[model samples]
Target: MILHTNDVFKVTRPEDIFETRGRFAYFRVELLSQKGNIDVSLKLTGRLDWTFTRSITLTRKTNDKGVAVFPVGRICESLIQGTKSNLITYVITASEYDHAGPALYAVPGFADREILPEWGDGENISQFYPAAPCIVVYPNAGFEQSLFFPKQTGELFVLTPSSTTTEKYIGNSAFSPIIPFDPAKIPSEDLGKPLAVGATPTDYNAEIRTYYDYCTKGIFLKWTDAAGIPYLYRWTQESKTDEMSVESTYHQLDDTLTPRDVQNKTLAKRYTLHSRIVERDVFNLCRTILGCQDLFMYDPDVGNWVRFMVEDSESEDTGAPMQDLVVEIVRYEYL
Candidate 1:
């Protein structure tokens, strides 16, 4: 049997890990004591540069093989990614035991080991790179959430009724009793033009039309107060129509009646918040925003700046004393 040191605590997972999505990433840590696989409570503290430090407690116990295992739950990837230095340092310790160990480092996203500068002789060398947008999510009230787009200024379009195909009857239906109808012998004719009225009984055929709608039912704008608390302001239908024009032709009629024109004809119903917007607190903002099931933000998976909604808050957890907000990517946008 080998003797393990009391200070043999270390993070076993997430080695050199980088998270692109703003979802929770799971990790694990291990601790060893001189007593050989004894049950012990350990504190795991994660520090992200000078911005903030979050710590969670875990109990490590011996398994059937007398080996200790301590698996941590999902950790907010955004909180760990926005560090100034882009490095997250973790330390594990136990009050009753002397198993305080060296700190472990985890890096978020891709980072070059060395950014070598190009050598220039006499002329000034200019390097151009695209700017990445910064996105942040905070609570508006209780569970309601709001997003902050520091670099985004243009209007965002939220699509609805994803289906683009619609059916409309073009032929007149004639009365038919005991008509010898064979499903396999159904006539296939041009459904675009109106069918002529005939005395012989004929079934009314439906013409399928596909189109996309540019008119939005509503708009939710993200705003902040003097205290920097985020809130979502829903735009009225009129306001949405005005903003809709900036992105689409709201009143223009299509000559050919495209699929988009057909979709635009469908109107969306108005939505009302259950609770007064003024009565909501900042913590409950996410709850209210999520309650509006019809609303959808931009996707972030394909762009540098991704929009996320607050899924959970760490302030309520006693173990994690830090005020870290957990957010998941809702939408992605390039610009």
Candidate 2:
């Protein structure tokens, strides 16, 4: 559970388990002797079809408190390649003497978002589910279907109205579904409109994500977490105003009324989005939209993801659910 780089040896350490010995209950026997200056080592071995193949071992001498300091999160992070999401499964073995402790199974994902995958009581799937249930995708964007959905054991199928394709997981490392959706299969009129596609292991549901996508139509904004998982949500109230800011001004010109530098003029788009957000989506918007590394709006007119940003704290106005439920996006463009 404790997977932070500096959190090791402080919060999460080996449990001191003791057993009873002798006929007298006063005498207690410990499974492992927790003595200072003792030799201790941690061995981490990957699970079935894991991405990381090499085994990791770290040896340390116990301190005065019989504590062996080992940073599990830091150790696992060193093996990660690139900035992509990595789903890892491994067993942790602690050794003090000749006897090896019980194998502790851990499934941790190091990605853009800080999603802690807890061990469910009857969890059978080897893969981890995204923190959010849905994603806001570009009409023709490509994404691995398995990354968004729980890895289903059966023959997974990705189907459209006009076609069907399949992927599997029993013997495969990961299954990726073709997501550059077909324009022909979709209604010509609805081709670029907002379509919330939901998924199951077998195939995609023929239904939309929310009922509002029908009645309360709006634009969807997208942002990714630290783990690189993207989240898209809809906001109906959209407005834009172009404000020109002059970096430098020169003498008065005939074409311009005021003394202005037309060549140095920059068009800053003051785009505003107003929407009544429900209780659940309020949190998702704050974390994903408010301080996102990159922000985009799905322009219904153009049917594309337009880059924009929430101007600043002042852009937000008081709203029922959250302060910034209504926000104006600002983007600067060279004229």
Candidate 3:
């Protein structure tokens, strides 16, 4: 009997050629013999490692169409475990009538990305929400709340909650309570305002306008996705701030300064992300999501946006068995 493989059977998915996990490798063979009931045996052999090799054999009679299809799925998962190398040299051979010598077909499989846990809709690991510009207020003993801010800078009128307030603590450091002021209390009398070097009382208005510009100049951070779409979030010091306190002792004669203690502190920003990946798109995540590291992000404490990388990720199953994949990501980052 004469046998050959079809061109369609040789074509493979790109991921299957690279990463075999979560995919199947298939091949078809056709026999040219006219006789029926001819017994044939198919054999597949491959190296699992330098010290061991594995082989599987299946025997059957060719169909009326003279075609036999082999679906080898997840076999790589078992053979590839605990192996240092991802490269596997394999051969598929067949014999007819139990006396025909083995016909040899050789191929090589290269392992690409490491296999991750199976993705399911219920396995989504992140939950994301659209964030807005606001001050997240956390009192010493009460639930946290948010204060909205306009994009423009202006005199801020602070509001105090009716309940008694205490200092807020981050780590071991304490932050003073936000001072509340009434909008009507803004001083209009310019008695304490500074004057320009050579300006008389009539020119105070111009000097005040120049000073306002200097005080308002500050840098703001901007965050964007891998596609360069900007995030709708902003930060402010009132919501969070970094503080450093140092204490030093000085010697008399040499005027040498000795350090006693120092404390550094800052509050971090966190985000919850919710997303989905269909079965067809799951294999491409390495390139589209995890691979892009230069994306922009917003910081709530700084009142500006800045560039950030995904520092950590966590996932969970979000669907029933054998369903599409969904993931929720709780992302953590630093400025």
Candidate 4:
């Protein structure tokens, strides 16, 4: 359909990030200066396909800036309205006096600025909101061709991009080990239950594990959908401060044959990472995985996925542009 690019009613919120059309957030639209005080209306769908299959309509007049913002709505109680996909689409529509006109996309529009969670924080995972995975494309320059992780249905697995290129984890989504390993060894919600003893993989994948050294790796947060779209999060550039602690648990034996000392059980390394300084978007992106009860991290030191925690209970945010983050993590998955 032909969209009216020069319409008086416009949406100026979801300024494109990278090459993506808009950020996944609320909808906001502004009226032309000459059209000030005019009524604006919006209809959003609970699906991601951008179709107005569901009917959710609202009307409001423009403010001084010719902009109208939608309230977060009663996410706690609102009945979600339709049974579309997990993702929701906000389609702002407007006309001079609330008369039927083209959709906000027909005009130009933006999304709400704040990355505030539409479904609230990780506080309630069982809530109706679903954190859909998004894909991003990387800039291709001089190098081997880029291959998306979580490859297509029948794509063969390739370990290396090229001889010169190091084994890289392009698709930052959960990965499957190159070679078969104990399912009990893998963590992270990406890989569900452990496989049967002799069962071959009929499902799943992993980040590269071959390339390893004594040195630490950069904290490059990443995510890519099966489509190969990439989303990179470089928080605080790199952490400025780091802290670690260890704890052990074991069973006591009162039997006369047993020794007085309770043998050490396991050493779970708990880490606290303090960022140098970062933007609010980085803060929000970092929180995407906080709701995962089975969240796991790949420990280069041990070359395995270990149970990971963000310590979200104590995390904080103030909405300012520049800020610092205190990330607490725990990594303990070893023999």
Candidate 5:
């Protein structure tokens, strides 16, 4: 098949940061083929591409009558470039096919935007509600939440742009190293058997772990959807301030542990496990509803973390109908 455009073009700035900067870029692709079945792939051919070197592929199959309007989607990673160039070069190639037909050359629209009005007009501000102590996450598509956690209070914005076509997680989503948290406590429901091994335990309080205070306090987590969409749920520690206690359980390091000592270890372990479960459950809930996969938690080692372990529907114990959807947590932070 004869290709329409020699190559595809994309435009972005500081190509390295797509997750926090929340910038938008325009992508243009030209398609040319004899029969329309152009088996083509697009790659970001730029120095900056290494920053977030990701790719998007579009496959068009001609209609029965040989007439097809191929739909192409642009992705942030696809437009990302390692080198600072005015225009990003994309190589589009196809295996030799039949002779070109009518020399059809179709150019897609550009998507780059000068400034995100949503960010400036305060459209996204409301979405960044405060989830004090810890934010509660639920399953809901098209609903997103965001918050800013500053190590030091200042005016600095981190952003990343996402394609409308990118696959987003719904509800009950899970990221890798899936940390399982106890589902929201039902008023009249009994929590089925204890959580599985290595899972976050329920009824955890502070005191036992010094780090819990840091993780739980000054936390600004925004539940959003695929492509960094925002929602309206907020969390506040004030409502339950009295409940924020650093209750501790002692650990009796003994060869022959006493019943009281065993209880203490169980309590300590439960506290730690509970924290993990909360993080995992909240993360998954956000991802499943948001519709973005690749869930990960930020760590010094990986530096850049992706959210994972998403489930879109309600669990068997929910006592509610399941919403078969994908959930994801796009952004989270602790100040």
Candidate 6:
């Protein structure tokens, strides 16, 4: 498989992302020697040679399905991303003593491959009929016997595994099942106003930004000041005093402008005009202008949450117009 650093392979104890949204999902690893039942536990390793150093014991028994469920014992304050570097290590050995054992599995190439392909590829779990339906109520809440997720009360959805479009929604075991986009209606009229379409109880901030390659050093942005002079802001992360811990930082680059560009130029004039260099305040600029930043934030802690982006020229390869700057807003909940 083609390995990519940005690829994510979700890991779980055979549950759904919606079910394990706010927790670390783990699997039940059992050891059985010729002597009958051999005790074994699971461990975790990281990029820095960091290891859990403890064998997490499994207490559940394997049913006729050969599937075993185990309780994590205590709530864990950890978060695992399919696209990150943290690896899950399963160690099987005797649980009675404090000794290391064989490493059952090591996710050395997890970042390059999807741990749960059927689940990750938008395939429905109901089609596969998993070992058992498991959901995570909260992070570090420990593995509980029963859990519940929110479901629409009166929503009608077609479930046909054979037909792709009119097909059934798979993986409905999560707290929130996927809502298929309705294609039976016409496009909503653009009333020349901004509309919000994303997660609610907003947990982010919005800003208009511009980014260009920083030669060969890194990446920087151009933020317009009150005088319309662009100022360079080096992207970085900081702590937010909200719900979780420190949140992801967004690099905001917004500017206010008059409707001068759109007002004077005629329809024909706008089409005929070519390249023009406009001057603003003095700030360092980069060589390659990446694109207009609709919403830009970088948290050394939190990661990117960009749902989509609208290009200026209606083309992915072009830049935005002069009069119009990027507009980006995000909802954030403080820790």
TM-score of each: 0.26, 0.46, 0.28, 0.31, 0.25, 0.23
Q: RMSD to native for every prediction?
A: 26.6, 11.8, 25.5, 16.0, 19.6, 23.4
After superposing all C-alphas onto the true structure, candidate 2 shows an RMSD in angstroms of 11.8
> Considering TM-score, which of the candidate structures 4 and 6 is the better prediction for this target?
4
Model 3, span 160-266: residue lDDT tens: 21111322111110110111222122133322332111111121111111111112212222233232112221112222223333334343433356444433333
The true-versus-predicted C-alpha distance at residue 9 of model 2, in Å, is: 14
Quantify all predictions' global Cα lDDT against the true fold.
0.29, 0.41, 0.30, 0.36, 0.26, 0.24
Report the Cα lDDT for residue 26, model 3. 46
For candidate 4, what is the TM-score? 0.31
lDDT of 4: 0.36
Against the true structure, candidate 6 reaches a TM-score of 0.23
C-alpha lDDT of candidate 3 relative to the true structure? 0.30
lDDT of 5 by residue, 1-335 (tens): 11243322111222211232233232223333343553444343322333543344444454333333322223433343232221233443344322221211111122132221111222232222221222343222122323222111112221111111221111111111111222232111222211111111221111000011112222123334443333223223221111122335555656566434323111111000011223433433433333332333333355443442333333322432332222222222221
Question: In terms of TM-score, which candidate is stronger, 1 or 6?
Answer: 1
Which stretches of candidate 1 lie above 4 Å from their native place?
A: 1-38, 48-51, 76-81, 93-95, 108-335
Highest TM-score: give the candidate number: 2
- Candidate 5 local lDDT, residue 328: 24
Candidate of highest lDDT: 2
Task: Report clashes for each candidate as comma-separated counts.
Answer: 30, 7, 36, 17, 76, 29
Q: Write the per-residue lDDT of candidate 6 for residues 1-335, one digit (tens) a residue.
A: 11111111111242222122113234544333223233334453222234433333444444443334443313111323332322233332233533332222121111111223132212232321211121111112111111111122222231222223323221122112222222111122311212111122131111102122222221123322221112232322221122233334444444654332221221110111111222111011211122333323323234432222212322122343332122222234332
**Candidate 4 residue lDDT tens string, 7-28:** 5665543311111222333346
Better of 5 and 6 by lDDT: 5
